[model samples]
Target: MSCPHVTAIAAYVKSFHPDWSPAAIKSSIMTTAMPMNNSNQVLKDFAYGAGHVDPLKAINPGLILDLSEDDYVNLLCDIGYETPTVRKISGDNSTCPSLSARSLLKDINYPSIIYQIQLMQPFVANFTRTVTNVGFANSTYKASVMKGSNININVVPQVLSFRSLGEKQSISVNIARGKFSEPTVISSPLIWTDGEHSMRIPIIIDVTQT
Candidate 1:
């Protein structure tokens, strides 16, 4: 059986990027990891969660979904923690932000998209992401998706243009869930390519039959 305790990749990445946060480190490992099987085919999520970790590619992940401390705090509170409970967990007396200020889990800055399917009902989720340019300047990246199941996936601003290094761009992933006859899961890739480097993010959708 494959071990679920996989921290070597994250630890290795942290050694080089000590300043990166936990989320960034995880994103690097997952976004750059291999999703292919020994036969060179894309493996399902049940087989591999973002596939095998690649140390080299992870070090220079073209883009990262950066999150701040406040983002996490808000995430916890949004999930139904009162102000005092949040303060206790954060080891600080910070008060919870107003409901209007809280961001949903789907809005968290994650490199990949994950959604819980609503049985017998179609749903839509929009995920916002920002990527900093670590590659060459004056480059444009085009977005593409490997179709999976019957979901309708679209990325706004299909093309990203960067004039200088370290420039950040925003991307919105709009996923419209499709009805499934049975409980199942589907996987796909949301890729951004500059005709040279490809930043691939594995997208997983879990469906349940009601």
Candidate 2:
């Protein structure tokens, strides 16, 4: 059942652009999904990962956070993988860097952000994302944040301009703790809109004692 569904979407995308990776196809499907059910009720937590697939919107998601094999290798290295093990998995001559040099798991080029923050510490988490424009050229998108909790969220380069199709731009999200007294998970969405299209990314911040 799911295989045919995925294949249809993949085929539609491939018909237009044959260069998209499996990861990109998956991201597009997830990020553009509808978060509501037939009754117009919002989906539950982690339901379908990013809710039910929206195949039409997935086709033209405006912007995509593409990933490569190196990104997966970095994800493994971030979780304390040794050089030899990482290199073995990658089947390459790559070397894992020191802990300080390793990329943070939250920094992965994913469609959504998931992070944990210490409840009592003065903490700030930064996530840098690159988006490839798939929408109209000469478009400008503005950033907006929707909150379900008390974290302070800011997006640098608040406005993005695309000169041509497939143009890539970098955006950074800076999240700082503020009045997060209760130990709970706070979820929000960082949205970028260009009047016609919107790129929405869900952000879940886990507040706990570290």
Candidate 3:
């Protein structure tokens, strides 16, 4: 069901922006989706990944978290893929970074944030993401979070200013777990609005006993 719907939406977006990459199309659909259901309840990431896709809104997602072939190669490297495997998959002489320089998985410039932490421990997960401007040539966006209890989420440089089309900006999301007694899962959103456009991404935190 969702497969066909998302496929059609992807095609629709592609028809409009023929130069956009698959990652950009996916980002548009995810960021422009409705996070809440018909009953006005926020959807969980596990149940509804990125909520219901809004085809119209997706056509103009304001900002897109576009990724390149190199980004995917880096992601595989960050996930501990061996150099030979990565080269085979990428069909290039790409090499993995040193262990000390490898990036965290959550740092991938996707349209969502999901992190896990050990129960009863203090931890901070920092994610770095870059978004390309596709809306108004001159626009400013402000970041806000609909955070859950027992967690603190902060966005560095809460405001992003874009001077022209295709401009890109990088921001950091720092998530720290607060003191809590029981293991639980929390779902929230990090939203960026530029007066006309509202781009959102889910932030899920799982506090596990293991």
Candidate 4:
């Protein structure tokens, strides 16, 4: 015989609600999820031939944004970002990983620091702006690199690998009547092996530290 049905259980299930929000829930699971943490003791662990967690590694994970570029520029420098007149400080560990600028503006704009580099070589082939949140909504301040020159650049990493998270796809600019060319932003940790050189766009993450 089948067991008796529990009305209360059914009622509870019907009343149950979803936690947090859909956007937040989606954010928790994405291609760019931030690192999570455990106990504080995790950080104090010693490092040698060892598997030990550290104090810093044990703290709660915060939000983060990664910046990259093909050409050198101040695209990530001195840029400012805030919430509708309410300037919230960046995280406590704001850092500039590359030699380029140590910071990015909350708002992405034109003539980016990266674009400035194209100036060094007016004879560019094709200029592509793969990242650099330029022309995006202010709510999502982004950084971008601008390029202009006359030269051919059929190099490594192709035109497709800058960043997938940024809105408004990358664009290519032709100066010498469509000859010179290069991508605007390049994903960091990129390997430029074929007569190619990678320029690390400097950036300062976690502004709170500043």
Candidate 5:
């Protein structure tokens, strides 16, 4: 039901931005999605990832986190895939680099963030993301985080200014575990707004004892 609807929306978005990559299209849909349900309650990531898709907003997402084929190859290599296996998967002579999967995962430029940590342990996770400007040139976006009480989240440089279309900006988010009573999943939204457009991405932290 939702799958077909989302697929149609993706197609609709792709029709408008023919040059956008699949990852860019996905980011557009996810970032522009509605965060609340009809009942006016906030949607959970486990149930409604990135909330409901909005086709009209998806057409112009303002900024998109785009990924290239090389990015996929790099991810595979970082995940410990053998050189031969990666080459076969990429259908090219792609080689593996000596990179850590943990580090690569944080920098993948995906529209969402998820981290798992031990319940009683001191935890700090950092992620870096880059977004490309697709909206108005000379626009400035401010970063804000809606975090849970059990963690502290910080975004560096807090502001992004794009001078021209296709310009790219990178930001780093650092999360540290705070006092908590028990193991739980903390859900937050890291949003970048330019007064006109709001780009939201979910940041999920899983705290487990085991």
Candidate 6:
């Protein structure tokens, strides 16, 4: 049987430039990272560590996540980098016109970044949320669209809508529910578009989901 433990490590370094792909990520891991063998120990430590914070519920029954990767962890509350949610419409939802999510990101100083999915990938220690953003262009300028998520998901447009324009796509990450076992992998297929001089944003998400 396959193990249920999952660990993910991410690095936004100069070598990666602005984009990445799954095949490339796989190759990278094989060359640079070691395959995890002892999953239970990590999971045990994470739960104990988090439980220490809340003494009252040290043994609270919940999902356990044990993730260890060479790159720095993307644990919440510890990251200087973030995708914060802002209220774009204070008025009524009916009165507030629906704006593209990309519009929100273009206003900031973020660069062109893309992420890929890793199928059957498992991870630990996480939360869940949904967010939206909006932006306006100057005279004769084009406005961008934007949305937000901790991780990007790949599914049919019916389930996971890929990002377009200047907006980021939304993902339903199990990272929040805290599912940890033995090498939990979340799988994300590669996504791309084609055209003359078309910009192919390669996103590599090497995860296992089981």
lDDT for predicted candidate 3 compared with the true structure: 0.86
Residues 4-65, model 3: lDDT tens digits: 98999999999999999999999999999986552433334776688888999999989999
Residue-level lDDT of model 4, residues 33-130, one tens digit each, is: 22232234322111111122122211211111123341112332243322222222332333334535332342232211122233223443343433
Screening candidate 1 with a backbone cut-off below 3 angstroms (N, C-alpha, C), the clashing residue pairs are: none
TM-score of 4: 0.19
- Model 2 clash pairs are none
User: lDDT per model, in order?
Assistant: 0.79, 0.78, 0.86, 0.26, 0.84, 0.24
Clashing pairs in 5: none
Estimated TM-score per prediction? Answer: 0.85, 0.82, 0.92, 0.19, 0.91, 0.19
RMSD each, Å: 3.1, 3.2, 2.2, 21.9, 2.5, 18.7
The ten-residue window of minimal lDDT in model 2 covers: 37-46
Q: lDDT: which is higher, 1 or 4?
A: 1
Off by over 4 Å in 5: 37-43, 100-103
Pairs clashing within candidate 3? none
Ordered by lDDT, highest first, the candidates read 3, 5, 1, 2, 4, 6
lDDT for each residue of candidate 2 in 1-210, tens digit (9 for 90 to 100): 877987898788766667888777777776676654423323333444566676788888888889878788788888878879988898998877677876678888988988877766667889998888888988999998976457789999999999998899999999887646656766677888898877778887877776
Look at candidate 2 and tell me the lDDT of residue 132.
86
Error of 5 at 174 (Å): 0.5
Q: Give the residue spans of candidate 2 off by over 4 A.
A: 1-11, 37-44, 98-101, 120-122
